[model samples]
Target: GCFWHHHDCYLFKVPATRTAFWLDKIAKNVARDRRDIGRLAEQGWRVLVVWECALRGRKKLNDDELGERLEEWICGGGPCAQIDTQGIGVLDVTSPPYRM
Candidate 1:
């Protein structure tokens, strides 16, 4: 992404299968991310974060089964295609999130 004054910028999100970012729990809001950004800016750095919902919306447009496909994509299986979740939430065993 383009940065302020034409500097380069990069964005990261809550990573799946990431060991480094695991916290005891995610806050009700993004207080953690905001705090990190403040710390980085204090050190003369720029940090960018892309929210899960934003990427999910874009992924939905490209993949027929954005839900299951997103799991495969996250694991480098391929560009997510689609899977029929049948309206099951995270607890559904058949869901990719539960299986993977």
Candidate 2:
């Protein structure tokens, strides 16, 4: 989940051992995700990134709320968006120190 994707959320944590390897691997995963999203978007495919934090956590949204959000985004016809513990919307992927 968030760990492999290197999401800046509560669920992601760099391993104490082999920290360098984990970080490198996670970084590569993040890069690949970005690249894949870009490719899909270029092909006119809508991309929705529902972060794990939004599904399970103290701040997780209820089923109805989550469903409503998904419905809105799907019907709204947005190119790309993300749902996290903070809320549902597009995040600045280019920004450093990414957060949910």
Candidate 3:
């Protein structure tokens, strides 16, 4: 979820206590995800990230909508894509570099 992945979304909030520790842990997870995605792309694998918010929140798409969106992505052919409550778009693999 966004909380664990530290996604910049409505669901993620740094904890009031042990803030630094939580931030560090989340940062590591984010880094690992980026690394893995990068490696897969390097090996010629297309990736699609469907964030939880897209499925469970107030702004979620209906089943048929989500299905059609996924189908389009699968057929359209792209290096990477992301689907969230905000809608579908190319995955932003770029950001300020993360340190391990």
Candidate with maximal TM-score: 3
- On lDDT, the leading prediction is 2
Local accuracy of candidate 1 as per-residue lDDT tens digits, 4-100: 1111112223447643433223331234444555566568653333223323432322344444445544454421122322211221222212211
- Candidate 1 residue-wise lDDT at 88: 15
Q: Residue-wise lDDT of candidate 2 within 1-100, one digit each (tens)? A: 7788877888888899999999888888887888888888889998898888889978787898889889988899478888877778874456523443
Clashing pairs in 1: 65-82, 65-83
Show where candidate 1 strays beyond 4 Å: 1-29, 58-100
Report the lDDT of model 2 for residue 81. Answer: 87
User: lDDT (CA) for every model shown?
Assistant: 0.32, 0.79, 0.78
Sorted on lDDT, best first, the list reads 2, 3, 1
Give per-model CA RMSD.
16.4, 1.7, 3.5
> Model 3, residue 40: displacement in angstroms?
0.4
Off by over 4 Å in 3: 96-100
Q: For model 3, name the residue pairs that clash.
A: none
Per-residue lDDT of candidate 3, residues 2-83 (tens digit):
7887666777789999999998998888888888889999999998888777788777778988888799889994888887
Clashes of each: 2, 0, 0
- C-alpha TM-scores of all predictions: 0.28, 0.88, 0.89
Error of 3 at 53 (Å): 0.2
Please give the lDDT score for candidate 2.
Answer: 0.79
